[model samples]
Target: MTIADSPARYGALSRFFHWAIAALLVWQFGGICSEAILGEDHPLAARLSANHTQVGTILFVLIVCRVVWAILNRGRRPDHGPGLLGYAARLGHFSLYALMLAVPTAALLRAWGNERAFAPFGFPIFAPRSPDQVVQTATAIGSNFHGEMAWIMGVLILGHVAMAILHQVAWRDGTLKRMT
Candidate 1:
């Protein structure tokens, strides 16, 4: 049975989105971090980097589903508690949604505009740029901001995790149970 969301907790779909995205993000950052620390040619880094585009495309799809599901269930999800924490929760979630869309969009735009063919899962999504000319604008945007915005997103995710901990430990609330 599909667990629909209730006033006190998230549904199966919401929890799936939450954990699935969280897992993919872990993969993305693992690749990024591994490349930075162990060099791009290292076996672990190479394997992860090789699948970056495919994983990213998957994440894009998941985010779209997540956004739609969230909107549909907006009224059914738990309320952000009153006062400062609530405001912080709202802002944090908004930032995550915005970044989730923005970061991958930048990469996808670059892939579409650049000379390289971007065929995630062996399906040609974006054809290569003209052989005679190179596109700099979109490539520049992706090169500049894809990693940068992701780091910011990473910070937000850390804050999110910390808040969950606070809710469970300090506040002694079942805030973390909403998704679990």
Candidate 2:
């Protein structure tokens, strides 16, 4: 498969990024759902929670790369098309990207300002902040909005999937084909 995007379809790299990120998101949400349903003390929830931060860090890195790649391929990528639907599509994608970045970033900021060290995959990214030295503003922002923003993002993602299915089955448009 080609590595760069073209007018008709997404290239291999783009598809890789898309699917990989999608899978990671599924994992992330699965963990959240398990914890919510089974309670935090459940074995499945414990298993998933063990790696949540590390997985989130990896996801954040992948997102940054994906955004950079999208920018690089902007002109070469498939067109969004004309009219109201297209505008809505563009706006929707923008919102997704923004939340994708914001969610992890807020988490990271919280970690940074936390009393304990911030390490993902056993690698330290931020050292511990003493109780007195903690950045309360960063901590508060992250604590206050991370979960709320994530739920909003979850809703948007469901809508995104619904729209994709609609385009494929009802509209009979090649929109799904462009990515798949």
Candidate 3:
């Protein structure tokens, strides 16, 4: 109920950011996975893909906000604890944050460098580049790495969930409770 995080547990805003981002990421992945598995023309896949760009844009904005909020609440949040397990936990979290930012950024860069206008949510984000002015480097990096990095991020997310479950069930620790 509190607005700011405490040593014992995350505050309302942090929890909101955490859960909202999780849900949005799930949605984004679902869209891509559906298209990858079912083919783009399939009804379900098509429906999900229809909103992919718009949803990604919204998710990207939310991520930036969440990172800023996390920085603002750094020391007040729950601790990872001492020794090796703690170090692993910290590293895992850092990886997650890095990918969360990187995946969308690469995609956005591609959009920006593409020949077509980049309009997510019907708002013009990037104007179409003229043929001679296209940024091949941005396009190439985005095209080459976005999907690969996303899959890596997906694996990391699964590991993150597994660890949370381990903490809640095996360790019988209050770690999962800190966010929940």
The global C-alpha lDDT for each of the candidates, from Candidate 1 onward, is 0.90, 0.91, 0.92
The digit string of per-residue lDDT tens for model 2 on 1-180 reads 799999889998999888899999989999998999999999999898778888898899999999999999998998888999989999999999999999999998899888989977778899998899999999999999888898899999999999999999999989898888
lDDT of 1 by residue, 121-157 (tens): 9999988878666678888898899989999999999
Tens-place lDDT digits, model 3, residues 39-89: 989999998878888888888898898899989999998999999999999
Residue 155 miss distance in model 1 (angstroms): 1.0
Candidate 2 structure lDDT: 0.91
Model 1 poorest ten-residue lDDT run: 126-135
- What candidate 1 gets wrong by more than 4 Å, as runs, is 131-133
The residue pairs that clash in candidate 2, if any, are none
Off by over 4 Å in 2: none
For model 3, what is the alpha-carbon lDDT of residue 70? 89
Candidate 1 lDDT: 0.90
Clashes of each: 0, 0, 0
Q: What is candidate 3's CA lDDT for residue 126?
A: 98
Better candidate number, 2 or 3, judged by TM-score = 2
**What TM-score would you give candidate 2 relative to the actual structure?**
0.97
lDDT at residue 33 of model 2 (Cα atoms): 89
